[model samples]
Target: MTSADRSSDLSRAGRLRLAVAQLNPVLGDVTGNLELARRARAEAAGQGADLVLFSELFLSGYPPEDLVLKPAFVAACREALDTLAGETADGGPGVLVGLPWREGDKLHNAVALLDAGRVVGVRFKVDLPNYGEFDEKRVFQPGPLPGPLGFRGLRLGVPVCEDSWNDEVCECLAETGAEILLVPNGSPFHAGKPEVRLQVMVQRVVETDLPLVYCNQVGGQDELVFDGASFALQADRSLAFQMGEFCEEIAVSDWRRDGETWICESGPRVALPDTDSARWQACVLGFRDYVEKNRFPGVVLGLSGGIDSAVVAAMAVDALGAERVHCVMLPYRYTSDESLADAQGCVDALGLRYDIVSIAPAVEGFTECLGPLFAGTHAGVTEENLQSRARGTILMAISNKFGAMVATTGNKSEMSVGYATLYGDMNGGFNPIKDLYKTQVYRLAAWRNANRPEALKGPDGIVIPENIITKVPTAELRENQTDQDSLPEYDVLDDILECLVENEMSVGEIEARGHDRELIHRIEHLLYIAEYKRRQSAPGVKITRKNFGRDRRYPITNRFRDRS
Candidate 1:
């Protein structure tokens, strides 16, 4: 039937059963994603749903990245959508799914509405996000303001992800006779991002006086973690339903025509997790998806007994079950007995496989080889780096032998100031706490020890030793080495880095915040100088507005510093 025919049929007032599939999609896994969508549709059908709604690019997966550029990949996504459309012949429930589409010479991020074995309508995203990790402008073309899609006798306004963040798209849909707004999003989780999303949607609702269903994709896509906190906002600004965060769900919301408008009646209303719990879940989900989606057998990491490594090990255990996590203590001559005990304590607490490998032989061999070259110079950072490199090598060798991915444990504070060794401790397939500040790392460790989420795979109650959390953090490359010896204390360092990295505050602006000018300048210089190191670092979960790799991109060769 024609779209006009469908619109005319929808003129009669009735109730519509809408299913929101808050699912996790693996990027570039078109077949897997298709299967996922098919299962969700079946589930919705069984639940007596009139329509199934999926997050943005549910078939191709959200933020397919550069994979969308490949015509073959786009073609595969289109084929999958067509196959899904054909399945609608059963007339169980229509499907509204997002995918990358190509028409003529333009590639657009589009959503297709399928009903009765045919694509009723397709709407393209208008506001292609470009800043802060989004590169939609770099890829797909921005489409014109779209009208609502005709679905089952109703004008369902479909806004793909970023379009609903603004007024123009939803406004146009409302003006064009859209009764209810369904926004499919690939919104990633950052600290307090849910509130931001709600505020944006609230503004749109207030403007258009339309009840909106905000469906977000859940799961980890590399550095990005989509918190599937999907919900419906009524015209009166009341929440109709709220899906759980950091988990997959297919919730059905009932909508009934009210006088000339449609309003959400009732559905799932799961409570959103607190900020800390949400962030921790995001980290765990991101790590798990990275390892599993990439087909890694498991993960391996060096358990230094330090807060950073201990927390990472806990996250690893939580992400992949304790059996899949291998914790190795790579000790050198300067490695402390306390560190050894703490490492063992953590492993025992988490019930993961533990190993102790001495790095003395490798460190001695490296020193012996480079002894002549360094004969005239005093031992310093280079020597300390050798120890880290030795440990990193041992972890990589373990990874190679066991087919386990390495989890780098460096936090944002260390990464910002180049405190981490490039090829040494930085060697890993992924870093779960890459964007968390050292202070935040300690807080997360304590939080995890005190409370275990139902989703955690590891044993409950203080997996990280209290001593590990209380002790002064150190690399232990020297006799009494501490991180503060090379850089400022974490409390001060994180604040400065937050200003410089996240806020992009100038040196003077930072100084105005009660920090010394010299200290700010030094930190800024170090942050800029470490661009090359960060450029080579592994991708990690993004927990902040500005993360190292995707959110904040800096030139390695640039000499510009915010001296002002």
Candidate 2:
């Protein structure tokens, strides 16, 4: 008997060798990606895999963004698919891969099942998730459910990524003689998202009574990263083969038939950290991938000694050693001694290279230049933004000179409302804290300081000064510029943003939840007005359900208000 027949666990019912290849594909690199896919397939075949599944858009790339509009790019993707299909004819292993398929005028976000060097079957995505970071509907057309492909007398159904989320695809396949369901996904990572996936997959398995293999893509793409964390759910809703999260791995598991149905027996359970811990690790990974993949030498950012920048600096140090992280303290005329001391404390604690670049010179230059324009205007937040702009310009200059990318440190709370300066404090190549709310920032800071994870390379023991966290948050634009002076408390602000952004609750709905009406309105106005700033903002780890980029797209020129 094979290993599958000998296994007694319900999780291992059908013994079929399967391989999941977690890959990172560069956008628009058709040739490179196809070759990478072939290499992965060859590797899987070497491991004795009967079938290998790849992540979504593996032939092209996830979130090809506007490149899907290019006709030539689509044609190149199709040609690459043809090459992959031709390879399977070598009598190697069957392959399930994501690609953009063109059928006359309709282009589909599809997965092709290849066997014996020929295209055997194709499954199309049914559910087009447009909300949040997905714009699938805006690009490719949804495809019809594909029936099972008969191979070696075993009928297999392939649900291309989003199709597996709903029961229709799996149900249709099961009804059409599909004994097993294989899902190829390019699902992105968010805080607590994998659990949701697990719940959904388990439910699908229970409903279909068929063993399922959940294969996902890995690595950062633009502002998003797909955490592989691929897993297999047996017919009895038990986890069989669990792959590692937030990393690359070529995992192989055997599935076998038990009684009348097939199931995957336990091979290994890849333990995942807690939700918050995973978010922290994902943030670090996102930063590393964005910097290294883009070929940036290092990173630089303003060290305000606040939780936001402090946490970002810590992540940067963890991502690219302390040697690669450059911290700058841009103090202005109104900057307090405590802030300065706190900034220094973080620098000293982390042992990173830092410099105190006073913004007085540039601030004075800008004030003198705009002297006539602001001659009669009362100097208020405009002056504070001037200080921020000065600091931003200085950091950008240093970045340009030293060939290091700037890491912006704005959290979701600041980005929710128009609290951040557009081209000023918002300047950076990446923002590690963009998805984290202010509360989350503080919590993560404390968590990192107290218990350092393996991903964190910085020194321990309060890398973010206590004074920075305890002190009232202030931009220090003017003499006494507290964040509360311009916005609501973080506790209140994050709640409103979550209701508005994630839950899609309107202003009235949020106000009904016991928040002040005027406060909600003000926050709403700030969020709507800040689209332009977010558009130009740096890419960051997407930990929340709805991040500023990709997830939420508001018109910068719209006049519509959420009065309801």
Across 1-564, the per-residue lDDT of candidate 1 in tens digits comes to: 554554444456478889999998888889999999999999999998989999999898888888898999999999999999999988578899999999899999999999888888899999999999899998999899888887767888988888999899999999998989999999988999999999999999999999999999999988999989999998888998999888888999888888987778889978888878888899999999999999999999999989999999999989999989999999988889999999999988999899999999999999999999889999998999999999999999999998999999999999999988989999999999999999999999989988888887978898999999999888898998888888888899999999989998888888988998999989989998999999999999999999998899888998887755
Tens-place lDDT digits, model 2, residues 451-522 = 766656777677777877788998878777788987888999999999988898988889888999988888
| Overall local distance difference test of candidate 1 | 0.91
Q: Provide the RMSD of all predictions against the true structure, rounded to 1 decimal.
A: 1.7, 4.0
TM-score of 1: 0.98
RMSD of 1: 1.7
Per-residue lDDT value at 538 in model 2: 85
What's the TM-score of each model vs. the native? 0.98, 0.91
Q: Indicate which candidate wins on lDDT.
A: 1
Q: What are the runs in model 1 whose C-alpha is more than 4 Å off? A: 1-13
* Top-scoring candidate (TM-score): 1
